[model samples]
Target chain A: MRDRLRNVLAGVLEVRPEEICADMSAEDVAGWDSLRQLEVMLALELEYGVRIPADAMLELQSVPAIEEFLTEHGAG
Target chain B: MSRLPTAEEIAGRRRQGLELTRVERPEATALHVLATFNLDLLPPFLTEAFDRVGRSVRPRAGAFGQLTQEILDPASRLYAEPPDEVLIVPAAEDLLEPLFSRPPSQLGPDEAEALVEERLAELRGLVETVLERLPAASCYVVALGATEGPHPHVLDPLAPERRQVELDRFMRGVRELRSLGPRTVVIDWDWHMRSFGWDAVRDERLWYLGRMRLNPTGCAALAELVARHAAAYRGQARKVLALDLDGTVWGGIVGEAGLGGIEVGEDGVGLAFQDFQRELVKLQETGVLLVVCSKNNPADALEVFERHAGMVLRREHLAAERINWQDKATNLRDLAVELNLGLDSFVFLDDNPIERTWISQACPEVLVPELPDDAAERPAFLRAASWFERIEATAADRGRSASYREQRERRQFERTSTSFEDFLSSLEQEAIIDPVHEGSLSRAAQLCQRTNQFNLTTRRHTVAELESMSSDPDHDLFTLTVRDRFGDNGITGIAILRYAGELAEIETLLMSCRILGRKLEDAFLAFLARRAADRGASVLEGTFVRTAKNAQVETFYPDHGFERAEDGVYRLTLTQGAVESPASIMVTVPANA
Candidate 1:
């Protein structure tokens, strides 16, 4: 689940999956701006078959937060 | 379903485009964006989309709030660097104010309707003001969405009484803009939001943060729509839709499975292919020439069309057909030569992945869209493609399939006849030289843009520009219509003459290559000479600018008694009595002439 989440975020950020970690946030990645945040959110939604609610999008700034949310939604 | 690229994907593509140092950008359509919201990302997205599809656009960033002032001011960047396509995306919040913010429960029905009318009138004026200033450039006015209204307005989209009124006003503005000219292409992204998701279109986080109206998904769709509009206006829209048979148009191969085995009827799995065929027929009616380039026995392919009880398309439905075994690439090239159309104008659709790859490598100019693996998905995927986008479907455009079919019949006659001149003479060809009318001006402009190989100057003009030229007193505009015994080719020639007293200069004169090799060119020149003499002009001067496609016409003037002057202009002294019309074609002149 972490590998998949990291890979999806990496694809959205145009970086290698190894470069993305659970603690990696917008502050760490150069391309991880608010726009990339939305991109990663949508990419994760498409990848995991889960629609992250608009309110939940704010918490998805970092990879760890997304992984936790996906688990709560019963997504891999 | 079409995948809407993530905004990150769009950004990455834009960065990739910036790295393309040697890639040639064809038809650099200068674009200006005037939005009520922040469109900081739209420019790159638009450019990237344009680059993807045969065009390259350079947007003059995007202006906010003071759109009217920026457009009209000569010293402003809008006028200083005037664009070819102006993309206007007015927000509902900016166009309609407090009334829009209020719920329908608060206002009476009459008040709501009245407010809608008042706001629409104001918007009409704003659009008109922009049009009047930038008369040359085309406008893609993005219709305002009513989704941004108050809680009830956003939540209760199905509340027809409230949302419908706002929508009606927005659509009314779009309708008025449509009436202005062919140049104004309306992008109905607002309507697309019904399926594109309101959440995606109106991302509240970005809207509040920086006035960014669309999310990444919405931005991708908008970029595609804008790029298609630009391509359509530039006259780069694909003309031919070449279809491959045997698991393509039908389910089974006609050569192997036989007619009964093919799944293309009204029932069950066959319904999908039938529905797909119906869409192709619809596209054919809208000026797209349909041809067959299948690798099968010609007899077997014809048998499928003839004997198949489920087949919707008949023999006459196609402009040309090459159902031979000799590879698809050669067949397409032969079709191009036969139809007198450029290979770039073709969009080949074949079900076989191997055949698609072959043509993609061989004929890179032809647009072959990625088809779904399943037959059922092919039709839906085909219909959604932007390759056949058109600003307006005129009568001439609709009659194109019939015209191409007629050309095929003419070719048949030409073969059977003894000689080329004999074939033309026996056909009873009539060339009518008449003043250009309102009905034929759109076709005239289309001919000006599309006709290249036999064209003298190879100049492209929009419908608006052609209308302006036709109305100009100095320019004597005449369009020639040719009709043989086979069929009417329908306004195949255009001659625009610029007269300065006795010395009349040929501003524009081009004929459709479809009507070439018919001696109509000779007749067109004769008509021009007569018109020049009628106006007491001594000489009819013509300028033959060299273009890659028009090299065949470089010696056109010298061959037609036009002596080259020192200024590089072709000069032909007018002699009313001596100017002889071709005996082969029966030339009809105006009664006064």
Candidate 2:
């Protein structure tokens, strides 16, 4: 699940999947702006068939938060 | 056509498109996109859409919520580097906020009408500004559709308070912009939303998260719609639809089922075929030529058209047919030869997978679409297909099938004549040559783009470019219309001449294949030479730039008393007098010329 979330984030951020760590947040990444954050939320929703709520979109900026949210939504 | 890509695939394609743009490619079409809402998700889907039609577009997104500013301001990025095409997408909620934010009951009828009028006028101004600034760009504007709020009088059929009435009025007003100029194409956003369903087009989560109105799925669909229009604008739209009979059109094989036993009537699956044929007839009316390319006995197929009770397509509706046991690929090639059209302009519809595969391999230029497995789905499939999409259908387009039928009769007339000179005189051809006017601008531009075989220099000029040239004092644009005893072939030729001191150069000279062998080219050249001599030019020049298909016209200039001075340039001295028109045809030139 962590690797899958890392891959989705890497695709959206246009970085290497190996370089994406679970502890990395939007602030830590160089290219993860607000627009890239929205892309990350969309990619995660499409990949897991899960609708990340509008309010939770901004909160799931880190790879760990996205993994936890996906698991809670039964996508893990 | 394949199914619409999923959101994941769209994202991946967007990345691929971005990577492709990093490496420079020559002759790539520049496309500038401006919208009212966030269009960050559109570039990737748009890239894939243009790529599907074998065109590479470099799309640059304008600032969000700056649709009007980008067009109104001259120094905007849109004008910094002019684009070959412009796509302007304005949302109803953003453009018409007063109508949506306030309930209909709060405003009077006059007030509502006045508000809608004001917004439409502003939109027209913006579109006209774009058309004026970019004389070579083709502008595509999306009409306003339904707003996102609820309606109090939604259930009422004739309620004035219903927002749909106002939206409908706005859409109609937007459609009128097509007449503003030939290059402006107004896309039916309302029809697209209704066809795609409102839920798929609008995402509430995205609306709140960002200002984005459309989700990834909706973005992909809209991109495809724009791409289809782009294809039509580039003169790449399909012209002929080759159909198969038997299990493809009707329920069973006519050879075995007999006319009476066939399942094409007013009930069950038979009605499905009937409905599908009705849709095809609509397509025919829009100027797409319908031809039969079936592998059956000629008698059995002709009998179906003669005696079938439920047949919607009659014998006269078909422009041509190849009802034989020959292979479809060979039959298509024969049809291309008969119709004087390229094989790339054909769309083959057949139910047999083997035949489709065979044609796809043998004649790769022909577009063979996959029909649905179920017969009931075929009508909807035809409606959804965008192979014959046109921005506006001209009068000549509506009467194309009839003209082709007349062409067949003319061929028969030619075979019976004693000699070539006798045939030319017996046909009684009349040619009317005139300067390009407002009424004939679209067809004139169309001739410039679609004519290939007889073109001297193949320059595909846009309507906007031609419109500007017609008003310039240095250029003369002429269009020719030919009429014979058979029928009137409308606006079949175009020629553009640019003057400089003592020299007048033929920038573009092309005639439709319908009137190629008729010696009308000589008469048309004569008219041009006279016009150039009257304008005080001493030398009339023409060039033959070689294309794969235009080789037949290689020696055309030298045959008509032009001396070859350079590799492709030919010069004819006006002091030697213009070439004479053939006595068999009566030619009429403009009085002013």
Candidate 3:
């Protein structure tokens, strides 16, 4: 689950897996913006086959939030 | 088509044309977009959409307003655009103004009928205007219906009935507008609405803030749909739908579980396979050739299509069947050769992921769509990809699957023949070479643009350009019509020649690969040489520009009694000599007639 979260973030951020730390947020990532936030949510939904409902994907800023979100959706 | 690209992602493709200024990029496949709202976010979505079909799209945007300027406007940014494909995405709100602004209860039937006519007429006029202005560009109109009516006003007694009438009238208007086919195609947003409903397509918040109405998902869907139209317009439609028998067409292994055990009946999970077969038959009716590639006894598999009561696709429905224990890739190659179609034209479907993976690695050109283990999702999975989209379905397109069957039977007869020449003479083939007219223009342009293997010089001309070439005295553009004993390979070959001074050059020479082994090229070239001599040409020169796929025709000129004048150019001196065609081929020249 952690690796998948890292990969998704890395894929969106165009950074290495190691570069995506736990404390990472939109401010920390150079390329992540509001538009990318929607893209990241869309990607997560496609990859996990579970659409993040209402404002749930909005809180997915840090790595922990994404992990928690995917785990709740029964996706790794 | 999978996911929309972020604005930051590939900032190069997104940021390149942000100025609304069109710059020409000759290499990449291009599409022009004319929209009512702000399409700032649509370009990257287009990039992502085109990426699915292995094409990188360079989209040129028109001015913001719908009726602002036509593509023919020299001052417009879209004037420099490729006239092959243009997308018209007029918002439904703009098209049907009164309907959107009012409640159906307030408006009586007479008013609704009047409004429908008004909307339809305006749409027709707009379409006609675009068609006249951009004669060459095939426009795909995104028909966004105002499907979301005002919430049921219970206070009004006859509101429901009026709404129904209004909806029917709207549909009739759309259908009538769409009837203007070939040059125009209306991509119904209803297809996308199925996945995400009207709530998702309409954006009230964005509508209030800016004129931009569609939500992000709606924008993505529209972009995907446009990209599909672009691919189809460029002759990239997948022609073959390859199906697997066991666990695919039916829900069981036919060898072990016999005909009765197969789950393709009127009930349970069997109904899913039944429905799936019906969908395939529908696709065949719309002109996609169906083929079965499975690993089972030929007779055993044949029984399913032969005798199954609930089966929608019978034995005759298939273009060709490869039902043996042979590997799929080998069978696929055999099918490609048999049908004379490129591997890129195939969409392979099998339930097993292993076989799909193997075929993917072996022949990456064949699209292997993933199918769920559950049979219910099979039809939807196959139908989801707009791989078989055609700009227009002519009579020739409809006869394609039957032509393949005839080719198969012809191939079988060839295997038992005494000699190659004997086989050639056996099939009585006749070719009618005529000037490119309206009916033949589309197919001629298709062969010109899409034909890579048999083409010399690989010159592509649009329909409008071909029309001019056909009319010009200096140019002779003819479509080759082939009919052997088996079937008519309609408008199979396209020859474009330029006659200037005493020398004539074969500007373009292409034949449909279906007629490859029939010794038609000899007849084709002979006819061209005779035409050139008639136009008072001293020499006929043909060039072979080698591409990755056209290596088979490297010695084309030399094989046909032409000496190499320069490196790639071959010259043949014109004489009152007769280049005898094969005895089987009876060439009909109108000049002789």
The interface root mean square deviation of candidate 2 comes to 1.5
Question: Residue by residue across A1-76, what tens digits does model 2's lDDT show?
Answer: 3777778888878888998976888999999988789888988888889998889998988877887888899996
Comparing 1 and 2 on DockQ, the stronger one: 2
> How do the residues B1-593 of candidate 3 rate in per-residue lDDT, one tens digit apiece?
33333434433333333322244435556667887665545666676667666666576666556444553355565656544566777665566566656765676668877877876787677676666666666667876665455444454534654355565566566656655544666776655556656675555544544455665556667777777766666667778899888998888898998888888888989899998998898788777999999999999888888888978888788898898989999999998887777898899989999999999999998998878888997777656657787767767778877887788788899999999888888888898988877778778877877787888788777665676577688999888899888888788899988988999999999987888978899898898998999889989998998887788788988888888974668999988653546667898877631
Q: Of the candidates shown, which would achieve the greatest TM-score relative to the real structure?
A: 2
Docking class of 1: incorrect
The residue pairs found clashing in candidate 2 are none
lDDT of 1 by residue, B382-447 (tens): 777888887778777888888887877788889999988789899899999888766776678788
Full ranking by TM-score: 2, 1, 3
Candidate 1 regions exceeding 4 Å error are A1-76, B16-29, B72-76, B104-106, B148-161, B412-426, B434-441, B500-502, B534-536, B583-593
Pairs that collide in candidate 1 are none
Where does the lowest 10-residue lDDT sum fall in candidate 2 chain A? Answer: A1-10
DockQ of each: 0.11, 0.62, 0.07
Give the candidates in order of lDDT, highest first: 2, 1, 3
Model 3 CAPRI quality:
incorrect
Which regions of candidate 2 fall more than 4 Å away from where they truly are?
A: B1-5, B104-106, B149-154, B157-162
